[model samples]
Target: METAVKTTWKIDTAHSEIAFKVKHMMISTVTGYFEDYNAEVNTTKEDFSDAEFSFTAQTASINTKNADRDAHLKSDDFFNTKTYPEMKFTSTSFDGTTLVGDLTIRDVTKKISLEVDFNGVVVDPYGQTKAGFEISGELNRKDFNLTWSAVTEAGKIVVSDKVKLQLNLQFIKS
Candidate 1:
């Protein structure tokens, strides 16, 4: 497709999720989701190739379904929510199937690549045009300065550095 006029898209947060999982104690995986987040995309193609994407998730919004653990995660050892307060991503390139972006957390930024499965665009019952995407990736938490460490009494690691990301996103054309 030729470069057309760029269209703006807003995230449909009510139907989307920004989630990640990391091994806990080297035996179990703990899943967490950001309860508050937003994303914007501007693109000239309906397929979203070469789009300019920006995303942000509140660091304090991290939820793992556990209160104490959640609070701990917000402390200095991890996100230090009060200090950094937000996680952000800005896309550098998109090729329909892959996305390369600079992901920032705790004020640290790193270029990361993610696999994107464009689920195509559709009009909803409300006559709104929406696009769906499944994006997945992995990164070392330590890479972003989230270097809190711990150990189990039995000599097991508390939190694994490797985090797996799975984001299901829906965006509406505006």
Candidate 2:
């Protein structure tokens, strides 16, 4: 009997991004990114049909191009970096198109499905084998204990509950 060695692919943070968008005041969109994050996947198949992925991002690393907004996100009103400094996700299944996983934020975990687009693999000019993927998903902020809310004096919402997540990932086989 022969044992197959699973190939481990680690995210190249320099070429990857973890970003999200949420409606602000029911009028405009606010975009944010986690400056520190990492992901890894192990697979035995060439097409990655059997790959299992796990990822995490530091809550304190949230950046929205605005210091005040970033600080607010790290406060108790949102991620609460002082208490839960990280968010995580682990894949349960992947079927080439849809990926079902458990996402944890602020100690609250929930199952979520994400659309995956495999951008194929290639050897970079630096002689490194790399794979790319564009993944998207959405979640309700309140579902993860990020339940802070506010209403304008005009009876409008200060923030929408829905948050759209986008991840552009690049991995190097390690």
Candidate 3:
């Protein structure tokens, strides 16, 4: 007889964050995050190769610390929040520490690969099991049609076409 084991993890929103950075004015960088997001993971074994992850982020939660700027980002020039209210990512493969997935934003879908490092898994004093992971990746914004920008006086685009994504995710076993 064979035994099967599966574990489920729910994202700890308060302890996790998703953020992105892109060049601005060819001299500085701008950073922001989606205020609301949800994700879950399931694994059939202790190793994460057989794991699955899926996440959804609310488009209206764009926050750059500036209300005016955030509102502009939600406009048609950028995410066009009225038409696409959410962004999502679904993992297709998890090979040890590498992850291959598809990310969909503003109605555009692109395949992205990330190098993930499993910080560790621990059992907390409260008897809860938790797993920590850090992932980093870069993607060309233009590839996803996030092409809103303006030429600066210095002859540079106000926003760079490359966007860098970084995620620190902590999940509690449920």
User: How does model 1 score by TM-score?
Assistant: 0.97
lDDT by residue for model 3 (109-148), tens:
9889998998888998989899999988999987877888
lDDT of 2 by residue, 104-141 (tens): 99989999999999999999998999989999999999
Which residue ranges in model 3 land beyond 4 Å of their true spot?
1-3
Model 2 stretches astray by more than 4 angstroms: none
- Model 3 sits at a Cα RMSD from the real structure of 1.1
**lDDT for predicted candidate 1 compared with the true structure:** 0.95
The per-prediction CA RMSD against the true structure, in angstroms, equals 1.5, 1.0, 1.1
Model 2 gets an lDDT of 0.93
